[model samples]
Target chain A: MAVNESLRVLRTIHYDEHHYSLFVSAGTIGPKTKPGHFAMIQAGEGFRPYLRRAFSIADVTKVAGVPALEFVVKIVGVGTAALARFAEGTPLPVLGPLGVPFPIDDLLPSDRVALVAGGIGLAPLVLLARTLAARGIAADLFYGGRNENDVLKRADFERFLGPHRCRYATDDGSLGRRGRVTELFTNALAGGVRYRRVYACGPVAMFRALAELLAEAKLEGSFAMESEMACGFGVCLGCVVPMVDGRFATICKEGPCVSPAQIDWARL
Target chain B: MTVDLSTAFGRLRLKNPIGTASGTFGYGLEFAHYLDLAALGAISVKGLSFRPCHGNPPPRICETDAGMLNAIGLQNVGVDAFLAEKLPELARLGATVIANVWGDTEDDYVAVVERIGSDRRVAAIEVNVSCPNVVKGGMIFGNNPEALAALVKRIRAATGHPLVVKLSPNVTDIVACAHAAVDAGADALSLINTLVGLAIDLERREPKIGFTTGGLSGPAIRPVALRMVWEVRKAIPKIPIFGMGGIETVEHVVEFLIAGANAVQIGTANFRDPSLASRLVGELAAWCEDHGVARVSDLVDTLRTRPRPDHEFA
Candidate 1:
């Protein structure tokens, strides 16, 4: 089968300026997507923007008797801007449940799954939080953004969380905590918050800082990375992360989600 | 419903003729994530030189109408690192690896082939003579048949790998260069690397590519590619030709074969769809079986579009 597949946009909802989440309808992969996996979304068809942008699958559910996928995309480039400005019913060229997902079974039953997110990175953590809750596993989520406006779907996160464990951080101190999300991490650890597994997802610089903070505390964690991909399936040699072994590895093929131990973070 | 993408250059069989060109596939190991290694016929890694290069910096690439312009300057990890790090990975991936070798001097070219000759996985060696993005060594050997034949003769002495000399489309007479390379003992030929072309951005009052101009590739280059393939096939009859440039679909593959290409390579298209090669394989099979074409090889030199030059196949 050709790795290239197209999806019909079930709906597109603009949450705020520069941020919108689309409900996409995919065939084979709709039911199988876990929290950490991403789908490569392209707005145009042939003679396209040519490449699709990678977005973490925010959540998946049966919508209106049809299996549907949700992509929480923050408009950044020409592709996302065009998609964001597009009408709700336009067909979206999408490919893959690309990249490795989080090891859901790896977390111990009693262990806390700490989700550290920055801004739009909250989408995957929110979905992961819900997945963990459904499995009867507890998770602590620290969702951060530039301000309250950037922190999307607060009610959705809180409502689904339902006493699961959640916190908020804004860079401008516009909402919950008066500082960065990393501050919340320091506060959580200082207050004796015990976690068996820590998963961090956000910008490369932010993740690098969090990786360092987690390392200094002698805590192990997994990080989800971002790479500009041609074919999210890895046919284009564009997306490559130099591994610890000095050989380059593709983020789309090896992982968007990888253990910090595997990355040569300095090269990133 | 089956596509026979397998192609032959002399007796060497390639499972699929959809591999990338030299300097385009980046040592062939980079696409492992997007594909199953053993699936394709072969991978032609980027052009490697004796000394390491920084490659042209950012703005090395620009989007053209149906394709793109790239002045990567053949940035490679030198010959030794390729054998030590890149080749093992290519070997593990299970493709018939073809290393595209380049050099600043004649001795440099021979050294690259010598080191690669030891690799059991290297199925063929492509001598890149047409790289326009670089200044000193690339365009020199390719435009002049004497220089190209001399280089081919030296490398032919260095190793016994299937030697394929890649021609530059920018040259006035590509057929002459093809004949020279073959006369120097080259087993096969590939043409033409990106045509030397330029696009200008009116708004910025600047050339579209950073290097002022770069190799043109993509759908836009197809007609020219096909013509050159036909011309070269006319130049050297019975010798295998690896035709490429802007090929995306199976129909495009058919066009190249009809133009006298024994095999073909997929470039630029990989940037759009990673699975395009595999899909083309499927499409080629169906087209053949449906047409009662017994062997895919029969498509080569079948176009008969132009009057054959005197001495073609003589």
Candidate 2:
């Protein structure tokens, strides 16, 4: 069941000038929330920034032995800026544990999954990495950003998945590889890596390219989709992605996590 | 003394005046997880057609000033699926369901109503003639009084259920459309459907919404909605009006009640707070009690405007 509660801001960890991680007292929504599940947060005080901002519940952790939920946010507009600046203990109205989470039940401990993320897209993958770590499952993380500053929480992923398992790329060559993360993914596939299962979360442009790559490689996996939406629940029908079967699926309902093959990336 | 929040719009009596606007509420069951479905005065499900619609392309909605623009093209599960799946669940939930009907042609509307009107679970049929996204029959009939009257007459002949004609605000004189619908046998009216609007993306040099234009709804249009409700009430004193536009609080609801709406539908605000309508029901009762209102219905159309000298008009 989904929940609507006034959760207190527990902590804010700034990774850089624009990127940060927000930890909040989970109330009843923390324990049940999975990696890809998201919450529609009333970020700021009033009606100025009218709609609730949707954020993936990055991690379910603890603060001083109390359960808390972490949301990784980037300063995009007024709503997010206000969220980043909120002092600890401020009450935030959140409706949550929404949408289908990443499917991990079928995977065996020996199966290695390829996890890809770009920019703030790393939020959900962090939790996925942690979940895999706990399950004795192994995976690789391919992260990309516009610049080194945009590359967030490197040490955290390293700590969770080991330093050798994480690869980084930057658009301006200020980080690991000198190009888009998709290029790094391409290089990995070209070097005889038979990745049959891949999980990804990024902007639409990145997804368009990744869809082609996934289809070409005959690989199957889930992608956490994003769209501008008024409600994180299904009712708004605003956050929709075109499906291959000529239907529109509300990303809030059918996903945040859907099979890459189900999306009609050309139309998207 | 506890204020009686029950209200009557024509023959349909509601537990309160707070209803979810069609489109914003989906099929009503979608919100069951977050709020009590039975607490709402009524649930106006999304606009239904004869066949399931895929709606428009991507970027269907974007936030503007105090509201958002949407060009969803009246997407729905069609009438048959609604009858087979949705209506039964809503009935089980004990929700007063208002099926909002839409179509590409006049017969399409009639067919949908014919399928749903006899369900007994459906409390009313809200005929959607004002959706701004579709290419045909929606705002087309809504903009022309003759067409709107003719369409309403046909639907009136089809069913005995309480019929509400939802009006478009994208017209020269809204009172004319209001009269046309009421005169053609509409038992009640819902105004004003989203105003047609456009927003452009500066970086891409293209429309933000795929449809290029979308219906603007939210607190941004509240004043215009209030004025239209007042004008329509003045034009047809007896017809029931379901007033809506960016209503988020009890005060906004009371403003509509005083402005002549017998009831109010909470629209876009539902996106921000899913439980707002249920909360408003209790809030409205409390507000009425605090204002010494014995019956919530007693506050309807109770606005007092200053009497102006004849020379002002001259």
Per-prediction RMSD in angstroms?
6.3, 1.5
User: Across residues B112-214, which tens digit of lDDT does each residue of candidate 2 receive?
Assistant: 9888766789899999999999999899999999999999999999989999999999999999999999999999999999999999989899999999999
Report per-candidate DockQ: 0.14, 0.82
Per-residue accuracy of model 1 over A170-229 as CA lDDT, tens digit each: 888888897888888889999987778788888877788788878778787877777666
* Candidate 1 DockQ, CA atoms: 0.14
For model 2 the local lDDT of residue B84 reads 92
Off by over 4 Å in 2: B309-314
lDDT of each: 0.77, 0.91
TM-score of chain B of 2: 0.98
- Docking class for model 1 is incorrect
* lDDT of model 1, residue B99: 82
The parts of candidate 1 lying over 4 Å away from their true place are A1-6, A82-94, A162-164, A171-174, A192-194, A242-247, A261-267, B1-123, B128-150, B168-180, B194-217, B220-239, B258-260, B282-314
Please tell me which predicted candidate would have the highest TM-score against the true structure.
2
